[model samples]
Target: MKALVLAGGSGTRLRPITHTSAKQLVPVANKPVLFYGLESIAAAGIREVGIVVGHSAEEIQSAVGAGDAFGLDTTYIRQEAPLGLAHAVLVSRDFLQDEDFVMYLGDNFIVGGITGLVDEFRRARPDAGILLTRVADPSAFGVAELGTTGRVCRLEEKPEQPRSDLALVGVYLFSPAVHRAVRAIKPSQRGELEITHALQWLIDEGYEVRSTVIDGYWKDTGNVSDMLEVNRTVLESLEPAVRGSVDTASQIIGRVRIEEGARVTGSRIVGPAIVGAGTVITHSYVGPYTSIAAGCRLLDSEIEYSIVLSGSAIQGVRRVEASLIGRNVDVTPAPAVPAAHRLVLGDHSKVQISA
Candidate 1:
């Protein structure tokens, strides 16, 4: 079996960050989000892989060159546009050949990995298999309806009136038969050939479609909130270690991993956090669920439940929480300016001036 991972898209939700970097490359716990998916794929025993890439193809390739580090022989396939999920499959047809493959969304995070799901698919040999999870907002996802026998009966993409709360997770398994399904399906109203539509096509053609509702944690880390949530979730299982230097003035509490070359002085870092290699934290409060990336400097700053990317510096900032700071950013006190009061008052507006 092979794997097809989709790492291409205009990540509008992540804005300025995505404008400069690939969304999949965004770090969770000081590691690229896509790296976890690649590790999971390698764990699933899929050797040959094809990565679908678009505008950020070069960056993806640079980071995942040859994929040997992840134990997969990867081949890059170009998708000129971010058409849709099924369109990715269509473009990767040559690399996928007639082999059964798993389509893993690069930016999606599935906590327990896909080994079990792949094994189940191998046993069942369904024409197509989809992973589903119960979500609070079904309308935000491609919702699915199941039959009495647990087969996928129907699906609707972002329906105004959802029939079920089971939303589609980003992992999917498909046999060569899906190639025909993708070809037979038409583009949706959104002008893209959605994978949901392709699966619906398979169901209409009398092919067996399987569905599994996973209870494990899963997320599409395309937005800031989800990214931070995933970071916290991953950090929960952290192991305490201090390979770096921590001065006597510093206090490190539970489950903190201080990477080599990192230094902490006069700082109190509390549990479930990571200080990446070469990062220095001084006279600051490094709170729980925070990941400070490599080569960063945090001086007299209090940070918690946040991710600070590489080469970034936060100095003299009182507090930072639940933030996704990008690479090479500098967070410092803004230069002071003369105080003034300029107001456009409403009917009952009250103003007070300081002498």
Candidate 2:
């Protein structure tokens, strides 16, 4: 079996950051989000993979060159536009020719991995298999309505009136029979050929369609809040280690990993946090669920539940929480002035102010 990982899209939901970087490449616990999916595919014993990339093809290729790091032989298939999920499968025809493959959305996070799902699919070999999870907001995702025998009966793409709370997770398994379905479906009202439509086609054509409702953690890290939540969830299982230098004046609490070359002095760091390599934290309070990336500096600052990217510096900031700082950015306290507010936000930016 092969894998098709979709890493292309205009990530408008994660503005400003996605404006400059690929959404799939955004780091969770100092590692790119897409890396987790690729590793899972490798673990599932899928040796050959095809990555669907768009405008950020060069960057994705640079990071995942030859797929040697992930134990898979990767082929890059270019998608000239950010079409729908079905369109991605349509474009990957040559690479996925007549092969049963798994389609993974690169920016999606599934905690337990897809090994079990892959095994299940191998056993049943259904014409189409989709993973479903109960979500609070079914309208935000493609939802599925199951039939009497627990088969998928109907599928809707972000329906206004959802029939069920079971939202489609980003992982899907399909046999070569899906090629006919993709070709038979028409573009949705949104001007794209949605995968949900293609699955519905398969069901209408009397093909077996399977659905599994996963109870494990799954998230599509498309927005900042979701990203931070996923980061915090992953940190809960952190194993503590300190390969870096911590001065006697510093206090390291539970489950924190300090990478090599990082130095901590006169500071206190709480549990389930990570200090990346070559970072320096002095006279600061690093609280739980915080990930400071490599080459960063935190001085006289207090941070918790936040992700600071590489080469960024946060100095003299009293406190920061639930924030995602981009790479190579500098954050410092403003000079003393009258009480006022200042913010230069980008598109879709969300801010909260204490009253």
Candidate 3:
């Protein structure tokens, strides 16, 4: 079996940061989000993979080289536009060829990995199998209708009135039967061919469609809040290590991994946190659930539940929490300015100023 990882789309939700970098390349625990999906595919015994990339294709290509790092051979396919998910599959048809493949959204994080799901698919050999999770906001994702036997009866793409609370997770398994479904369906009202629609087509055509309700953690790291949440989840499982230099004044608590070349001094870091290689933390409070990437510096500041990207610095900042700081960015306190008061003394207007 092969794998098709979708790494395209302009991440407008993560503006300014996505403006400069690919969303899938955003780091969770100092590792690119895309790498997690790649590693999972490799673990599932899928060696040949095709990555569909769009807006930031060059950067994605450079970062994922030959995919050998993840123990998979990768082929990068360019999508000229950010079409819908079905369109991505249509474009990757040549690479996917007559093989059964798993489609993984690059920015999506599934905690337990897809090994079990792949194993089930290989055994059952359904025409299409979709991973589903119960979400409060079903309208935000593709909703599936299940039959009495728990088979997927229908699928809807972000419907205003969802029939069920089960939302489609980003991972999907499909046989070559999906190629015809992709060709049969026209673009939706949004002018893109949605994968949900393609699946609905498979169901309408009397093909067997299956669903797996995942209870494990799964998130689409498209926005800042989700990114931070994924970071926290990954850091919680970190092993304690100290490859870096730590001064006597520093205090490191549970589950902290200090990579080689990182230095800590006169600071207290509570763990389930990671200080990446070459990062320096001095006179700061590094709280739980924070991942400071390589080459960063944190001085005289306090940060918690945030992700500081590579080469960024948090110097003299009082506190930062639940933030996603981009690479090479400097976050320092603004210089103080003298306070002044001005009053618009208009006719019949009452004004008050504190002395």
Best-matching candidate per lDDT: 2
| Candidate order (lDDT) | 2, 3, 1
lDDT of 3 by residue, 70-144 (tens): 999999999999879999999999999999999999999999899999999999999999999999999999999
TM-score order of candidates, best first? 3, 1, 2
In the range 62-85, model 2's lDDT, one tens digit per residue, is 999999999999999999998799
Q: State how far residue 275 of model 1 sits from its true place (Å).
A: 0.6
Residue lDDT tens for model 1, 188-292: 888899999999999999999888888999999989999999999999998789999999999999999999999999999997999999998999999999999
RMSD for each of the candidates: 1.8, 5.2, 1.4
lDDT of 2: 0.95
On lDDT, the stronger of 2 and 3 is: 2
Q: Rate the local accuracy (lDDT) of all candidates.
A: 0.94, 0.95, 0.94
User: What lDDT score is found at residue 25 in candidate 1?
Assistant: 95
Flag regions of model 2 displaced more than 4 Å: 338-355
Against the true structure, candidate 1 reaches a TM-score of 0.96
Model 1 lDDT on a 0 to 1 scale: 0.94
**The 10-residue segment with the lowest total lDDT in model 3:** 342-351
